[model samples]
Target: MNETELASYWNNNAPAWIELSRAGYDIYRDYLNTPAFFTILPDVKGLKGIDIGCGEGHNTRLLATKGAIVDAIDISSLFIESAIKMEKEYPLGIRYTVASATKLPFNNDSFDFATSFMCLMDLPDQEQAVSEAYRVLKPGGFFQFSIEHPCFKTPYQRKVENAQGDIAFEVGNYFKSANGTIEEWIFGDAPDELKNRLPKFRIPNFHRTLSWWINTLISVGFSIELLHEPYPDEEAVLNKPKLKAAREISYFLQVRCRK
Candidate 1:
């Protein structure tokens, strides 16, 4: 699918995503992935930043709270609308725009740093998105991003429960790259009462190998600085037992690179 078609899928997903995520149904993100991203993130005090593919601006608001002047963009106008509404109510001083990551609407060297939270894997053209991020960053600026771990979250993934009731993931297709593959599912941790009522979010899965991501960043003039594989901790598993699977296999990958 093209970028326009992909945006529609996310636009459709925006309402449920905003509701469920705000209600704390996206446990892995709120509990593990995002916390890990911020744990390793360098201080952004007084820095200018852009958050590409910033869904509903939750993480973008977090960046703003960290003392960064932030510009956040999402391809889906609906997502941008929700983000802008929150910005208006909360007044975080974030500039939210409806734009594509592949074609950033900004001048060269426009930001001190950049970020994308669990978004690159959904873009149709990952390389161009990375290049646009490079184009917008000032000298020595770093771009930090997080995505579903390619090695573990692949085109073929199955939940395996052993006789002992231990949950594990059986994943394959690491060598395969999926473009705009429609994945229909709701957050596993969502309350069963609410899950039955909620529409399954239709997300476009664009899968690429670990090497492809690293090489693409390097090709776009970003020097690899830090690589992180984040999984939920024991305390998190206690709150949400489904997160135990993440402890067994990596669920998210965070990368930081310099321009």
Candidate 2:
């Protein structure tokens, strides 16, 4: 699919996504990926930052809470509207706009830092998005982003339960690159009571290899600073058993690169 088509899919999925994610249903993000992402994130106090694919501005607000001047953008207008509504109510001084990450609206050297939380995989042109981030960041600025682990979360993934009810995750298509593939599902960790009442989110996933991501950043003039594979700890697994798979194999990958 084209960028416009990808945006249209996100627009359709935005309401359900915002509602569920705000209600604490996105457990992988809340319990595993996001916490680890912030653990390694550098201080952003008094810095100017842009959050690409801000998604109702959750992580963007976190940046604001850390004393950064944050401007956020998402291609889905509905998502941007919800983010703006929350910003107005909370008064975090964040600027939320509807824009694509592949073609950012900012000029060169516009930001001290940039971020995208669990969003790069959903973008149509991953290379261009990374390039835009590199373009907007000033020298010595960094862009930190997280996404599902490319090796583990592929186009073909299956959860198999044995007779003992032990779950095993199977992944294939690691070498394959998908343009835009529709993946219709709700947050797996959400309580059954709430999940039964909500419609599944229709997310358009674009899959690329881990090497592709690394090479793209390097090609865009970003020096790789850190690579993190976030998995749940034992305490987290005890609290959320659904995350046990992540303990065995990482669920998310976070990268920090300097321009």
Among the numbered candidates, top TM-score falls to: 1
Query: What local distance difference test score does each model get?
Result: 0.93, 0.90
| Estimated TM-score for each candidate | 0.98, 0.96
Report the error of model 2 at residue 117, Å: 0.6
Model 2 lDDT per residue over 1-259, tens place: 7878888888888887888899887888888888999899999999999999998888889889999999999999999999999998999899998999988999999999999999999887889999999999999999999998899899899978789867788899899887778888999867788678878888888899999999999998999999999878899989988888777777889999999
With candidate 1 superimposed using the best TM-score fit, by how many Å does residue 129's alpha carbon deviate from the native? 0.3
Candidate no. 1 TM-score: 0.98
Assess candidate 1 and give its lDDT: 0.93
